[model samples]
Target: MFNNAINAYQTIQNEGLSDRETEARVLTQAARRLIICQREWAQPNLRERLGDALQYNQRIWTIFQTEMLEETNPLPLEIKRNILKLSQMVDRRTMDTLTEPEPEKLDLLIRINENVAAGLRGSVTGPVGQF
Candidate 1:
């Protein structure tokens, strides 16, 4: 029992946060970057900040898409399909934002990230529309 406990502890230490937690953290970070740019819209570096934030969000969603597409991914088929659809929306919106450069346009992306993170963290007390 002691050896098993030690092995479990070692595994935890090596693995760190679970996949859900890691995903939630990354989503939160992406939301944070967008939020910063949204709030600092008047700043001189707003374009650069917004571009960076949008790219970061795109990268995150792209990673999710790739993971969901993997044969070994354990998520349900419906869930994977839904995530892929969502990533496509993110890609479209990101491109629109990049070309037009509007502050209000980031709102949907921010809410999406926050709501998804909340769901991943198992703290989604309300619907996505509420976020």
Candidate 2:
């Protein structure tokens, strides 16, 4: 468990992850873990693992929300606004899942994270609204 935490911290730390590709890679990996947790929540003795994954995902979203709100962030104004809106939705969905313990509630967040990560990697060719 400690090793997992250390690795997560390392992923979010300063090993050139500021670049778009690295950022997308980290987000995709983290999102994949969260997706797995959501899918496997019913397995034997996995409740704590689900909680840990959710918390990790929450932390990542919180960081993105905070960064997007900063005055000096370089993204276009419309993009920042939309991201901030999406972040709010993530916050709400996260709280709802925590309160209700419904794994299905995580699907939207999974799609959002995956879609954004894919967009960052330049693989998305369609409108993001469908995600």
Candidate 3:
């Protein structure tokens, strides 16, 4: 699934998607990796796999932070602030999970990734305030 997701992202990229679509694919890929790690937590290779997944997710959020912080970014100030706040939450949760290594700790990261990806794709179903 991980390889398939990467292939899908690459194919989407080659097909000339908008930036939001590319970002959505990236977030979905990250979320899928974390979901895999979470589901396989009891496997013998969990430590290494979890570390890689967490690092991958962290890198994705870090890229988002860098983009949002750029002075030329076009997002409204309120929206940028909200995204940064969410990224901060991701950062803290990531650090906590790295320190304590709990299976349940991955839920928030997964949810954030899924929600943000959905939002990027304009498929969010709930009220706007929920996001």
Candidate 4:
């Protein structure tokens, strides 16, 4: 999970996005990865790892949102809304998984992440809170 986050961060940086935007994008990616892990891996240990990843992603998102909002150049509303939506999805998935997931559920989650990266990238510019 850490490796995935690192890879995502590196990818964003390689694209020349600002540090703040890169971090936000990476966290979003990490959250998406966790969603994938939760759906694909059946092992209890793997599920626990996914939980950890979710927690970490939530922390990153919270920090990013707060910092971005405080910046003189605030993030656009569309990006902020997307971030909130992603966060809510994580929360919902985690809550649902506390029990047991239905069949084909993982596939749905995989699809969610598959499209989220592009949407996240398209939502904002000039870093996460720099309008």
Candidate 5:
């Protein structure tokens, strides 16, 4: 309950931000968390926390895929398909990391999230994130 409250408060802090800003923030936050989770994989007490972080990241991608797949979504079909494929890759990679609990396995997930975030933030020139 306390954790949910904290999360709600944190979410509320970003309530007035634009959608692009929100997306960039979410992506960056997920990537940052995965980085921390990766570094702490060897700690005895961090296993559950690591799993939760992976699941959190997965949930973010799932949301993106769901939104992109909607008929009202304005993105081109090719872009939507590409995003869904990337999300699926993230899901599979997350499961692989969760199954083996390896720090090294987080590299690809980190790269994907960071790259997508960068593109969304306009730091990288791309046809991404029109939504």
Candidate 6:
């Protein structure tokens, strides 16, 4: 699944979209999928897996954001700066959460999985326009 997402991200980049936009979309979708996967796999060890996945996804986003900021893309400089700031905020938050100790870490993962599942279910069953 990660590989497939990476391929899709690459396709988007190849099609002339700015790396920032392509990465934002890909990371958002990947994060959603990781949450869903954690909810589905709900095992005792799933918290560790979720933490790892979160770290990996954040790393991917950070790398993409860094590369995009360094590149001389045609995107407006201000927009690029904003994207970098947002990406840094996300990276910091994810890192802070993932670095929490044991039980706290587990609790965080469970809450995240539950929230994602709730949102996913709501989107699927609620009014068509709600999501």
Instruction: Give the lDDT of residue 74 in candidate 3.
Output: 95
TM-score of each: 0.83, 0.78, 0.84, 0.49, 0.82, 0.53
Q: Considering every candidate listed, which one attains the maximal TM-score?
A: 3
Off by over 4 Å in 3: 1-12, 125-131
Clashing pairs in 4: 75-129
Clashes of each: 0, 0, 0, 1, 0, 0
| Residue 23 local lDDT, model 1 | 77
Instruction: Give candidate 6 misplaced runs (Cα > 4 Å).
Output: 1-8, 11-25, 37-42, 101-131
Candidate ranking under lDDT, highest first, comes to 3, 1, 5, 2, 4, 6
lDDT of 5 at 127: 20
Candidate 4 C-alpha error for residue 73, in Å: 4.2
lDDT of 5 by residue, 17-71 (tens): 7666667677766777778876666778788878777877787787788889799
lDDT of 3 at 6: 51
Give candidate 4's error at residue 3 in angstroms: 14
Candidate 4 lDDT by residue in tens digits, 39-105? 5677767756666655555455455455546646467877767766765675576556645745344
Model 2, 1-131: lDDT tens per residue?
43554466566656766457765665676677777776687888566776776677677667778889899999999998888898889888878877787778878877887788887777974423233
Q: What shift in Å separates residue 61 of candidate 5 from its native position after superposition?
A: 0.6
**What local distance difference test score does each model get?**
0.80, 0.72, 0.82, 0.56, 0.75, 0.55
Better candidate by TM-score, 1 or 3 = 3
Q: Give the distance in Å from residue 64's predicted Cα in candidate 3 to where it truly belongs.
A: 0.6
- For model 3, give the 10-residue run with minimal summed lDDT: 122-131
Off by over 4 Å in 1: 1-15, 125-131
Q: What is the lDDT of residue 108 in candidate 2?
A: 84
Alpha-carbon lDDT of model 5: 0.75
Model 4: what TM-score? 0.49
TM-score for predicted model 1 compared with the true structure: 0.83
